[model samples]
Target: MKECTGVGEMSEMGRLVLLGAPLGNPADASARFREVLATADVVAAEDTRRLTRLARDLDVTVPGRIVSYFEGNEERRTPELVEVLAAGYTIALVTDGGMPSVSDPGYRLVRAAIDAGFPVTAAPGPSAVTTALALSGLPCDRFCFEGFLPRTPAGRRSRLRALATEERTLVLFEAPHRIAGALADLAAAFGPDRPAALCRELTKTYEEVVRRPLGELAEWAAAGEPRGEITLVVAGAPPVPAARPDDDTLRAAVAEREAAGLSRRDAITEVATAYGLRRREVYTIVHT
Candidate 1:
C-alpha cells in the first residue's frame, strides 16, 4: 500500500485491467493486450525494460505512464495503483512474461483493487503452467499447482512426503539446474514407476516436453542439465488398497503390541509401518 502521487485521476468509468503478456515470443501477445496497452492511462509492469521492449516489438507505443511493479516493490506499489484504480484510471498490469499473479506480482494489486470494489479484468494469454499440464499426458480434469519445490533437501523431501498421497495430478515449477534433483526426490517419494512429464523451454524455439517415469527422468537428467523454463507434471498416487482387516488380523496385531507393552499410538504406527498401510487406515480398524 505504498503511496504514489502527482499522477492525475481517471474518469469514474475507467477500469483496472490485468494484461497477460506472452511467455517469450512477442507475436504471441493478443490483440486485446495490445489495444489495452495502447489505450490505458497507466501501464504497471513487472520489469519496465522488458515491458518497453515488448511494446517496441509490438510497435504499439504505450500512451501513459509506465511504472515498475515487481516482488520487491509490490507492497509499496499496490496502494498507489489502488488509488489510481479508485480514481477511475484504466491501468494495464503486465509481467515480464505470461499473466501477472500466476507466479508473479499482479496478485497484490488485483486483490487490492477487487477488495476496494474497483472493476478488474484479464486478457488471457500463454500460461506455462497450463501448457505443461496439457502436454503432460496426465489427468488434467483435476489438478493442483505446487509452485517451486523447497530448495533444501530435507524441506523438499518433507513436501514430497506430504503430497505422496495426493490423488489429483500435481504441477510443479523447477529451475533447469535443479530438475534432476527434483526428479530424484519425486522418484523417492512417489515411487519410481509414477508417470511424469518434463516440459522445458515451453513456447520457445527449443521447447521440449519429455514424458517418462520419474526414475528414468532422474537418471537422464543426471547426465546433463536441460535448458529454459521447466515445468514438471507428476501423476498422483494410485488409490490405496481397499482390503478390510479381518477380526483375527486386527486382534492378533493388537495382542502382539499389547504383549510388548506398547501404547496404542506406538502399536498402530508399528503395525501400519509393517503392513504398508496408512496410519489412519490401521488406526480405524484397531480402534473399531
Candidate 2:
C-alpha cells in the first residue's frame, strides 16, 4: 500500500478524466457533468472550495476524495495525482470555470498520465472562448486564441506589435481592472479604425457584447472600470496589395535604402522588383 498526495492512491488500476466547469451560470451544468461530479472515485480541482460550492448549487454530493490541484502546486501535485492514477483509480480534474488546461490547470497532470500510459478522457462542457467567438460578429472561419495579454503595458504593446500583421481573427482574455488599458494598447497596435468586440460576463446576468472600432472601444472603456471577466475578438488585418511604385519613386526609395546600408546591386534589384520594372532600368537610373 502506498500513499500519494492528491487523492485516492489505494487502487491498483489508473485513469484520468477532465471535466469542464460552467463559466458563470450553474444551470448550464449538464447531466453527465453532474453524474461525473457525484460518482468520481477521486476528484481534483483548481479550487476545492469552488468545487464544493458547484456541487451544492447542482444539488449533487461528491462521493469521493476531494483534493486541490491548481497552478501554484501543479508541479508539486502532478506526480502525486499521477500516482493515484497509476494505482488503479479514476481521478476527475476540474477548474473554477471553463475547460481545464485552457487558461487553467490540468495540463501537467494530463501530460504525466499520458506519459505513464494511463487512460485520459474529458467531459466537455461550457467554454468562454467558443462562446465569445460565436457572438463576436467576427469571421470565425480562421481565428487564433491568445489566452491573456502581458500584465505590463510595454510588454503588452510589444506583443501586439508583433501580431500587427496577423491575418487571422484573434481572441484574447483580459482582467476587468485592466480592460481599458488593454483596449488602448490594442488601439495603438492594430490601429484606431480596426474592428473589434468586447465580451463581458458571458453567460451571466450582466452579459454584454460591445462592438466597435479599437479607438472607440478604448475611449468607452476609459469611462470607468468595467466589472466581470472580459474577452476580446479583433478582426483580422485587411488584405492590401502592394502598390506599383513609379519610376521616380522607385529610384528615390532605392537611393534611400542604399544610403541606409543596402548594397548598390541589392538596392537596384529591390527598387526594380518594387516598381515591377527591369533591374537594368534601375541600374541605368542609378548610373545615368
Candidate 3:
C-alpha cells in the first residue's frame, strides 16, 4: 500500500473550523461551539484571554493547545497552523467576538488552508453585522456589509462619496471613539436627511440603538461618544422618479459633468445613460 503523503488522504488530512464567538452573551453560544471548544486539537484565538473567559462562562474546558492569532501575529502564525493541520490536528480559529475574518484576522489562514487543499469549515454563530441590520429597521431586502470605513476624515469622506449613490442599505462597524466623526462625515456625504440607525453594545447589557436621520445622529454623537462596539446602518439612496428631460435639461446635465472634469464624450455618455436617452441625442443636445 502506498503511504498517503498529501491532503488527498482523507484519513491523514486535518480540518480548519472557524468558530464565531458570541457578540456579547455567552448564552448565545451554540452547543456545537462548546463541543468544538472542548475537542479540537488546537485553538487559535484572536485573544487568548477572551477565549479563556468565554470557556469559563460557557462551562466548557478547552483542553487543546491555545495560541494567540491576531492581526499582529496572523501573518507569522498562519504557516505554523497550516503545518499543524497538515499533521492531522483539528484547528479551531476564533476571534474575541463575532465571526473571524469579518474585518478581523483569519482571512489569511482561511485562504492559506484552502490553497493547501485542506478542508475548511465554519461553525456559524452570532454576527454584529447581521444583528445590527435586523434591528436597524432599514431595508434588509437589499443591503451591503462594509466592515469598517476608512479611519481618516478625508478617507472616510471619499469612501462615503463613492457610496452616496448606492441603493442598498449600508452596514458598517466603527469604534466608539471615532463614531462621532464617522457619523458627521456620513451625514455630510449621504445627506443630512438620510435615515440611519446607530447600534451600540448589541446583545449586551446597556445595548442601545438610535434610529434617526443622518444629521440628527451626527448631532447626537457630537454631544458625547456613546461607548461600546458600534454598528451603523444607513438607508440607501432614494430612487429617482422616472422623468423625461427636455433638450435644455440634457445639455445642462452634460455641461455639469464636463465642469466636473469629465471629457465631453464621457459626459455625454453619462448623461445619456442617466436619462435613458441615446448618446447621439445627448451629443446633439449639447452641441445644439
By TM-score, the best candidate is: 3
Report the Cα lDDT for candidate 3: 0.90
Q: For candidate 2, write residues 168-248 as lDDT tens digits.
A: 999999998899999999999899999999999998899999999999999999997778989899998987657766667
Task: State every prediction's TM-score relative to the real structure.
Answer: 0.79, 0.80, 0.82
Minimum summed lDDT over a 10-residue window in model 1 is located at 1-10
> What's the best-to-worst order under lDDT?
3, 2, 1
- Local distance difference test, candidate 1: 0.86
lDDT of 3 at 83: 94
Candidate 2: misplaced stretches above 4 Å? 1-12, 242-288
**Residue ranges of candidate 3 with Cα displaced over 4 Å:** 1-11, 245-288
Summarize candidate 1's per-residue lDDT along 168-244 as a digit string, tens digits: 99999899888889899999999999999999888788889999999999998988899888899999888886675
Best by lDDT, which number?
3
lDDT of 3 by residue, 1-288 (tens): 232232222247788889989999999999989988888888999999989999999999888899999999899999999999888778899998999899989999999999998888888999999999999999999999988999998998999999999999999999989999999999988899999999999989889999999999999999988999999999999987569888888888888999999999999999888877889988877887
Please say which candidate is ahead in TM-score: 1 or 3: 3
Q: Which residue pairs clash in candidate 1?
A: none
lDDT of 1 at 26: 87
